[model samples]
Target: MTLNTLKATEAATLLLDWYDRHHRDLPWRVSPPMAARGALADPYHVWLSEVMLQQTTVQAVKAYFDKFLTLWPTVENLAAAETEDVMRAWAGLGYYARARNLKKCAEAVAREHGGRFPETEEGLKALPGVGDYTAAAIAAIAFNRKSAVLDGNVERVISRLHAIETPLPAAKPEMRRLVSELTPSNRPGDFAQAMMDLGAKICTPKRPACALCPFGGSCRALTIADPETFPRKAGRKEKPLRLGAAFVAIDSSDAVYLRKRAASGLLGGMTEVPGTGWTARRDGDTSIDAQPFAAAWEACGTITHVFTHFELHLSVYRAKVAQAVACAEGWWEPIASLKRQALPTVMKKAIAQAIPHAFKPV
Candidate 1:
């Protein structure tokens, strides 16, 4: 089929039919049959799933989703939760900003929006962390509005189906336009999910199952035999390396001194060991003189963690002191409860390096 013959209605119909048979069974979603029978999806669940899904794989998100639902069970409950508790629950998820905004958005919805999600894209966009894509997704999937949902999966599917040549970051606009044209008014939720499922299970990044694709006959990239190469990305510049130091102070009671990060910037609102500022240019103070309090500070080794923009190498230091040692603004958390703290992956890595069994599951 040619580009002109890429009938929107027919494509949507085919994809929706495929979706009815093969959509992923997720914890947060109501099945198509249930949806058709007037079972509307919970906006809270949809919003939570979308937030967790950002920059995270579905497999990685499943357990976390289930855990959050079990813990809070409702938006009101989440809103009432302590910010520190929420951050602890979000540990290891990465992208700490999302966790912080999740709490803020929940509080806003509970307090300002009466514990209900905004049904419209614009209203949803006003919520913390709900950007254009997230708003569109929630509006369409949870509310069944006819909004065009264009996540990375949908973008790749559209780019391959239409054989869009412009590399990504630049081609996103054209891809959105094409998705808008194809988005149908009826069953918009199912249609949106169908596009995503196709990209994930069939039109994958490599070796797309073209023969099994519902749009095989219509996909322009399939005709050219290079569907994997569509949605091309520009070359990425090497991430700059940054250096820092982490100080792990264990008291006589086997409690580790930890503090909360500032409420802004990377890894904000999360817990960490006291350390020197990770400046943009210089490595943190690696000398024992920079220790939080005088103790037998020993080099525990170094840990390298990669963030989105830079690589961080932290010089790990360990010091065991008496429980009564006066220190800066931080608490002495029992080492056994380390898993319950809102330590980021990098922090966990540093702790593991200093105290080998610090984070081991009991």
Candidate 2:
């Protein structure tokens, strides 16, 4: 049925009923009082998870989220953590900026907001790294507010339900408006989760199982016989390629050389092998410097990684030095202790390849 055809109460009831049986057994959803309650996913937990989940897959986030909670436990604890600690915890998980923001936001809450996460959407939005989607999610799920929650999953569900023909990037605004109108006041959290669950499980991006969807009878895209084509996407731009150089210098103690990235920009606060910016240049003219080296430095191998904005080609160099250099910007970390430290994906890949060969007993 059209959104205008159904009353708010009826729509909410149908969605909630479907949610009761269909919601995934995610660890974050259980209440604090339940015997199975894990870390009592409060607004902080929910907000953190939602932020990290953006542009990240659920499977990949599970271990990282659990590790974060184990290490920090609460927002206050997170605020107390050293920048490097937080970044390391966020390592392997792409989008280094989110990790930096996560720390900045936690500190803001602890210092300015008096250690309590703001309950209102507007208040939450004012904090660092909190955006409309994240604010809405926290308000609805944590505080049981009636705000509409629209992420990619919701977008797909709404697009198919209305048979929207406008390709995505252009269709987002109209979809959000329709979703807001359809969102009900009562049980809004359940309704939002229900829609997300429905879209993920039934109205999936590929070959949506229309037969199992609750709204299949009323779905406009289903009636048209082409649900996947409703919410089309504009052509994507080709990813640009960039190249970087990283140094893997080791001392007699078997400690690997690491440097702290700049406080802002890509992979901030994470530990990494000192390197030069990824640029488009020929080998002979390239100005990339592999941090000051004592012994001869030789190119070991190259690592290719993809980021949201561009592709990176990293050239790894190995060198052995007599003494650990004091650069004010870096430290020597033993190879065994590397896992305890946070390193960006690119850094991690570079280190993974260099350790065995670069640090081998000579």
Candidate 3:
């Protein structure tokens, strides 16, 4: 069947039926049956999970989600919580900006919005870090509004269902329009969740299970072209290479020197070891001479970490200074307590490279 030939109501009903039988029981989500039993999705949980899920995988986010809920339990609690504490809890999740904005949003909701989330998409979008997709998701799931929720999974499903030819980003508007058209007024939340679940479970990117998909007959990609081949993307540009140096100053008691990053740039407000500024040019001083303090600095290999736009290669150096020699602007954290710090993954890699046993279990 063609795109126009497939009735929106029919497609929604089929997918909802499938979803009723098989929805993933996630910690943050109130499944269809749970909704039927008078349970509603929590806006705070939905917002937190959506923020964490950006550029991150579901498996990677589960523990963090649980941790946040346990720590705050409500938007008001999160607003009252310390910013530094939130950053520490959000450590290793990458995207430090999200953590910063998460704190700001919680404060806004508690202080400005009277401790309640807004019911519509526009109101939700006004919150910090809540973008178009996030606003739609929260509105539909939490408020039962007829907003089109299109995340990566839904994008794949939409692009293939209509065989949208335009590359993503550019193709997003058309895809959204189609989704809005297909989104039913009754149980719009369930319809949106059904699409996401269908994409994740059946219409996967690689070798989609066409035999199991409810929209198998109506899908344009399945009929005219390969289903997996739809949702075409533009070619990716090569990530630029950035070079830097990391200095690990350790004392006799197995403690490493650590400092906080700047409040507003890459890895903002996170813990890091002494290091040179990352630069794309070799003229930059990524050498031992750029060490934070004078000591017997020895080269200890290098660490390569990939960021969104650049790949960083940091030359590692370690120095065993006296226990009396304390860093002027930073604190000495014991190696065993490193896990509790707000260190990003790159900083951890640098520490591990220097000590080798810094992150090992006792």
Candidate 4:
């Protein structure tokens, strides 16, 4: 089916009808019935969910979203929170930069916009970390604006619906145009969410359930074959491997030494056990000579972590001391309370390698 032959209005109507029966009941969303009864979506919740959803899945975001809501009930409360506390709360959620930007955006909304999000996409884009897609999502979902919300799922659905064979990154513009055309001025919020739901539930990436899709008749890929292969991705380059060594120091009371990373660059502003610097070309010093201070350091296996652009292999070492030793920077944290600290996944893995149950809840 060609784009011209696929009646946009009819498709939207069918999708919305399907959504009324099948939309996912999420914690952050206002239902269609609620929305029709003059109940508007909360911009703060929408924005927070959008930010958390970036490079993260819906299932993974729910707990973090709930935790944030419990800790800081409002945007003003979030804005009033200390950056360290926010960072600590946001630990284990990769992409630390987003946490920082979330704080900045909340502060901006609280201070500049008077705790009210900008209703327009343009205004939302002006806030920190509010990119085009996030701005469009917020405007449509929160303010009921007629904005084209093109996320990865929506992109897949559009590419398959029209069978746009152009490889992605290059085909995004065409997909955006198609989305804009299909987006109805009325119920644009529901329309956007409907598209998202259709993509996620029926028009999935692998072995799509086309028989159950609302757009089965209108989808060009279904008319042809292999709807799963519509949005072809560009070739990915091999991620480079980097090496480092982490030092886990423990005193008699079962307290582990931990330190905060610098306020910039990768894994910034997160808690970690002291480690040698990681570089692209060379591995960090793993010899006993590299110990922070004189102690009975023993090798404690190794942990490998994959980042966005690279992979990291760290040689872990553990040292037990009778008394606390002074270091250039950092403090001793009780091993039982290690889970409460702002440790990233990689750091957690390193610690877990030394003390097996360090991260378990008390």
Candidates' C-alpha lDDT: 0.89, 0.78, 0.89, 0.89
Q: Which 10 consecutive residues of model 1 have the lowest summed lDDT?
A: 279-288
- Regions of candidate 4 where Cα sits further than 4 Å from its true position: 1-3, 36-38, 279-282
* Count: clashes, candidate 3: 0
Worst 10 residues of 3 by lDDT: 277-286
* Global local distance difference test of model 1: 0.89
Count steric clashes of candidate 1. 0
Alpha-carbon deviation at 271 in model 4, angstroms = 0.8
What are the per-residue Cα lDDT tens digits for candidate 4 across 179-243? 99999987898899889888888888788888998776778888887888889899999989888
TM-scores for every predicted model: 0.96, 0.89, 0.96, 0.96
Q: Give the alpha carbon lDDT tens digit for every residue of 25-107 in model 1.
A: 88888975787796768999999999999989999999999999999999999999998888989999888899989999999
Candidate with more favorable, higher TM-score: 1 or 2? 1
**What's the lDDT of the predicted structure labeled candidate 3?**
0.89
Q: Write the per-residue lDDT of candidate 3 for residues 66-118, one digit (tens) a residue.
A: 99999999999999999989999999998999999999999999999999999
Ranking by TM-score: 4, 3, 1, 2
